[model samples]
Target: MNALAIENLSHSFGTRQVLQNVSFTVAEGRMCILLGRNGAGKTTLFSLITGLYYARTGLVRVFDMAMQANPSAALAQMGVVFQLPTLDLDLTAGENLRYHAALHGLPTKLSKARSREELSRLEVLDRIDDRTCALSGGQRRRVEIARALMHGPRLLLLDEPTTGLDVPGRRALEQHVRDLCRERGIAVLWATHFLEEVAADDDVVVLDRGRVCWAGPADRIAPELGVGSVAEAFALLTGSP
Candidate 1:
């Protein structure tokens, strides 16, 4: 089964519709980039998927379990990193991860081991005892990513995870996520407006005005849009000029 599936998802805040029939699927062990500008409804779509808000229409399935009907099962299979930082500034990195693991019912020993593994993978294991507020933006982001993986989720959802990072930091985080897919076989749905974050081999879903304007391999986008580059194709497809 696909790692995640959204069928005809539509949502509205009062009378203002935010998402209109947005639908897509992320295959297991692959990365699918959700590309859209601000106000393109990416966060709204994510909120629905993560059950922060219920969809007024349509369905969301994680690992073949309906999100609304089987929320626990569905959510247990996914990890999420929101755009804004959610870490406790005063807490140590290890403490933060242990807290998340506990919330997921992980045993103390297992949580510690997992936390060590993930933090080491992200190259933040040395900062495990440091207060989160003392870490740099990139280090904190890495800690967040490690915390998200504490529960061993099969699907990962990252919303603009590289926001506010320098060029090298952004590249490092992006490569780390791609490596997670390659090495750990985790399905990832990464939402971002930056074209450079997308690899040529990546699957892509472009949202324009709260709707999917295109969804396919990144390499195919330019040709399909009759443009010479993905950036130009994106501008053309989204009518951004």
Candidate 2:
């Protein structure tokens, strides 16, 4: 079954339309990059998929379960890391993770075990007791990723996950997430405008002015656009050239 599926999704706020007939599917153990400029409806689509806003004209399905009719079951299979930080600076990394586990109704023992496993995988287990305020930006982001995985979600959704980090930090986080997809078979829908984050084999979804303009493999895009590289293709497709 597909990890995520959206059909004919359209949404509007007040009188301004944000998304129009957006549709896509993410396969298991694959990463699909959502590419769009600012105000291109990427965030609006994410909000609709995550149930932050109801879709007026389309259907969203997670792991073959309808999101509107079975929100809890659909959401149980997914984890999300939003564009903004959601951690409490005053709390330690472990504390923050535990709080999330409690909200998910995870038992204490299982929560601690899963937290330790994920933190270790992210290479931040040693910092578990440190207050999040004391951690560096990269370290805090790692902790957030670990927390997102603590519930054993099958699908991961990340919005601009590498936004503030330096080059090395961004690369590290990307590698870690890629490893998660390969090793654990977790499907990922990573929304970012940064073209460098996409890999040649990754699936690409391009949105322009709240509409989907293209969806295919990264390598195919360059050839389809008569360009030498994905960067060049993106510029041409989006009319940024």
TM per model?
0.99, 0.97
Error of 2 at 156 (Å): 0.4
Instruction: Supply the TM-score for candidate 1.
Output: 0.99
Candidate 1 stretches with Cα past 4 Å from truth are none
Structural RMSD, model 1: 0.7
Compose the digit string of candidate 2's lDDT tens values, residues 116-182.
9889999999999999999999999899999989888999999889989999999999999999999
User: Candidate 2 has what TM-score?
Assistant: 0.97
What is the C-alpha lDDT profile of model 1 across 1-241, one tens digit per residue? 6999999999999989999998999999989999999999999999999999987799999999999999999989999999999999989999999999998999999999999999999999999999999999999999999999999999999999999999999999999999999999999999999999989989999998889999999999999888899899889988896
Poorest stretch of ten by lDDT in candidate 2: 232-241
Local distance difference test, each candidate: 0.94, 0.91
